[model samples]
Target: MYAAEEQAKGKPASVPRFSASRRNFLLKTGGISFASALVLAASGCTDNDAPNGGSLTPPNTTAIDLGSGDTGILNYAYALEQLEAAFYTQVIATPYSGISDAEKALLTDIRDHEVAHREFFKTALGSKAIVALKVNFSSINFSDRTSVLGTAKAFEDLGVSAYNGAGHLISSPDYLTLAGKIVSVEARHAAYIRDLITPGSFSSNVDSNGLDISAAPTDVLKTAQTFLTSKLDGSHLPS
Candidate 1:
């Protein structure tokens, strides 16, 4: 019933619940400890497993592999952040027609926040960070107000769910803490965008249990494909 109403309002649909492979992986690794400060709790892992810092090279074939373990989770997050940062950058660069001054400022703030989040993950991941991603925004009619806000709403909602679903997959307590902080910001973005699309939609995102829905990394990437030119490989991520 809630989903039907939300869909009727043209809001993002809730992700259907799936098996808990990601949840199981989290439980198994939550107790394991890494030997190195930069490596995952799993054996034979190291920071060197990732690309060089500040490298903007996109992978060939347009398919990225989110490797197994905690690094994979971070890469998954970094990928999403890159998409968001690129999106808001374009949004601010070319404001949608009839956009208000207040809206412009708010969008700019969102852009800055996304860029900061993207850079934070990059810095945190260091050598483990994936290369810069290439995005496809051909579907978005950036000049239209409805189109822009709608896309923003979708991205923000997906981000919140992605983080919530991946929460348990994170084995490191410190990393989990950091993710919690970021997800809270993402949730705020979702709420703001939702309200912009429909006044009083802030609560529409909450389920009957008063909890936000979560999506496995794979499922999240499936939706993200709309804006991405590259193919995402979340198969390697813990599942």
Candidate 2:
């Protein structure tokens, strides 16, 4: 139905597909995992300040403010997930030239996971969710493997750090717990992408204390704005 709709609109259907076995695996296990997270986030994890839901409103300006408090933090995350999901979706739809079966399978899995994360945040944010972001991917050469994976590596690393940086701002333990779970998955993705780029370099980003480096929201948003066509205002984000 989705493909047909796209065709009817004269747009090439861009849906990503995987082998039957992989599809079934996602339908079973992936569904359960994200579903549980969604329930938790929507039920008991919402911040008290955003009882009616956080607003993505930007003050009389073109830039979209992420809002303050935990709401801002979650929206910040939602924006990053949106970017990752868009990148991987494009990667799968147009596989890089010479992409091997193993690489294809791994990338496809990453794409699905990103889509799950994107949707989970959108649903959990409810009406407070920001508008779907417009991404600028002109810098990426999807036809080349190195270009694709390098961008993927950057995105995964940035995502992990973004979560780690913002985790301390969350006052609600439930919300903090959810962020921890999501960041751990992001770390796994960063490790996998790193190893793919340079064999046995998964731990390259760790500090002397054996901890991954974290970036403040201002820093993360500064880098993220490069790939986003929509202007993001992190000035109001919790200090």
Candidate 3:
């Protein structure tokens, strides 16, 4: 939970920032390159891991409710992406000790991808988008490679499962399609991070049925709340 002073601040501790070159490119291309052609088509109007269960109601009255239906789902995703983007941004800002050049480059790419994903949801949702989330990463030690990679692995795996679980809840085909694309990218991230931890454990999390594990939104939110200062009310989310 955030302190009263922190809550009154009304801003995330770390907001993802893009380079000027990337910003200029996005402006020139109308963000099609990083966000995809679908973004231009609509202008565009649009649209975790935790335990394998948890309550949907927030822990406190000031919690941010995700609302109901598809819009609620989008907000849920945006919040997670915000958390990911913030985590990676901090990782890059303070490189873990003994970090190799190869590792740094790869992590930087992941950071950029997360930032792009975060921006995409924010743009698509427009007025419907929730406020930027306040993330709590004190548990992570940014100076240690083991700690950094471990957290990265957790976040990536959680993200993949989150999308898999939420897919059915999305009623819009366009939103579903977009979700599919993003999840695939997230899976790739998960695989890469897993391999980094263990040479060939990339697919270790897959089930006996050759499918990745999925968790309900309730479960995901329960775990996600651990790293978030803002309590989330998922009770109104689609069942």
Number of the predicted model whose TM-score against the real structure is largest: 2
TM-score of each: 0.75, 0.81, 0.80
Checking candidate 3 for backbone clashes, the offending pairs are none
> Model 1 reaches what TM-score against the true structure?
0.75
Cα lDDT tens digits, model 1, 108-220, are 77776677667656655666678888899999999999999999999999999999998987767767776776788788778878888899988798889999989887678
Cα lDDT, model 3, residue 167 = 94
The candidates, ranked best first by TM-score, are: 2, 3, 1
Model 1 Cα shift for residue 125 (angstroms): 1.3
Residue 31, model 2: Cα distance from true site in angstroms: 5.6
Candidate 2: residue 212 Cα off by (Å): 0.7
Q: Which run of 10 residues does model 1 get worst, by summed lDDT? A: 26-35
Off by over 4 Å in 1: 1-62
Tens digits of lDDT, candidate 2, 73-124: 8888999999999999999999999988977887787787788778777766
- Whole-model alpha-carbon lDDT for candidate 3: 0.75
Question: What range of 10 consecutive residues in model 3 has the weakest lDDT sum?
Answer: 21-30
Clashes of 3: 0
Say which candidate scores most in lDDT.
2
Candidate 2 TM-score to native:
0.81
Residue 78, candidate 2: alpha-carbon lDDT: 90
